[model samples]
Target: MTDIETRIEQIAQVIGQFDDAQVPRNIRTSSKEAVEQWLLNKNKEMDLRLGMTASIMDEIFNDSNLPIHFGPMCLQVQTVLETLLNEVRGS
Candidate 1:
């Protein structure tokens, strides 16, 4: 991955460990922002995944009558990420 992506992941990981037990305002808010950005990226990734899944599912379904489809993981992640992004942006 690129340097910027690596840094963002690192920052997100640090945010994962953050708790509001310390400074409940400034540091907490910073950590929250880090997490929100990470979630937004995940949401973008999920869009890509959903498109791929749809194409693959179309091919597979046409080839076989068996029931097969992508799980709801991508949709679930997207929903969570969107909610988090909205919350962050609203803040």
Candidate 2:
């Protein structure tokens, strides 16, 4: 299995590809606005999924008394995503 850092960065890089590739080509200018709105909504949904995942991880951490290092590794993935979302929203 890949280590946490490598796997997270690999996922992030794939998401970057999706950001560029997910949209339909030959969209009308008026419809392009709608597509952009859909992308933003999808991004928000991704954020929510990440939040829920982290919450579940937090529950496990609390119940098991896992290493402090372990909690941050998972949380750091979410933090990286939050930064990406902020940048997408800002743009």
Candidate 3:
């Protein structure tokens, strides 16, 4: 598989580890907001090819009422996204 596809699969694996009751409500909201903000900032620097990826991420992060169990997965996804963003920024 391609690198992006591989990363997306890895993220799905991480997300599959949790259930809806494991995360706290507050954490879910915070994580979503954090990811949304990060994506917004990164969107400015992303190439056209990555725009669809960013839009998908934005859709995921835009949900303010995601299950509490999703918090950890969100953080993991955030880490992966941050790494990707940093790469895009050449940091």
Highest TM-score model number: 3
- lDDT string, candidate 2, 26-88, tens digits: 212212332244322345464454344334434433534344444454355446645654554
User: Candidate 3's residue-wise lDDT over 1-91, tens digit each?
Assistant: 7565466455544544432455555544443443344333444444332344344444555566655555455555666765765675673
The TM-score that candidate 3 achieves is: 0.40
Models 1 onward score TM values of 0.29, 0.34, 0.40
Candidates sorted by lDDT, descending order?
3, 1, 2
lDDT by residue for model 1 over 1-91, one digit each (tens)?
8543454455345444433353334434444554564332566554343333333323322443322232232233334444443444555
Model 2 CA lDDT for position 86: 57
**Judged by lDDT against the true structure, how good is candidate 3?**
0.49
lDDT of prediction 2: 0.40
Return model 1's CA RMSD, one decimal.
16.4
Instruction: Itemize residue pairs with steric clashes in candidate 1.
Output: none
Which one wins by lDDT: 1 or 3? 3
Error of 1 at 1 (Å): 3.3
Off by over 4 Å in 1: 38-91
With candidate 3 superimposed using the best TM-score fit, by how many Å does residue 91's alpha carbon deviate from the native? 8.2
What is the C-alpha local distance difference test score of each model? Answer: 0.40, 0.40, 0.49
Q: Locate the minimum summed-lDDT window of 10 residues in model 2.
A: 22-31
